[model samples]
Target: MVASSTSSRSIAVLNTAPTQPSAVETFIGNLLELVIHSIEGVRGRLVGGSPQR
Candidate 1:
């Protein structure tokens, strides 16, 4: 299916796309990322490998 710019509904959907990730969602995502990064860093150190932070 194709979205036609002539339709107001399609335009609204496009606008909402950027706001889909709200503040709380973004925060949780960032927190999860940091946790994953820390885990990887520790694993790297244990394996005698360097992790580029």
Candidate 2:
């Protein structure tokens, strides 16, 4: 995640409230979903204790 980009987006949100916040909120919310999914996937692959596949 790029901190700069996220900060810009947040500033935009604060400057101009979307007509429907739920839509924009969902878009931002998906960022976490993707991160969690990626972490779970990597953890699953690493669970065997050996890095070598």
- As a TM-score, model 2 comes out at 0.50
How well does each candidate superpose onto the true structure, as a TM-score?
0.57, 0.50
Candidate 1 residue pairs that clash: none
Off by over 4 Å in 1: 1-21
Per-candidate local distance difference test: 0.78, 0.74
> Tens-digit lDDT track for model 2 on 1-53?
67998889877876797665678778769988888877777887789543323
RMSD, one per candidate, in order = 7.7, 6.1
Q: List the residue pairs that clash in candidate 2.
A: none
Q: Which candidate is the best by TM-score?
A: 1
Cα lDDT for residue 17, candidate 1: 90
Candidate 1 lDDT over residue span 1-53, tens digit each:
55565466646655879665466467889999999999999999999989868
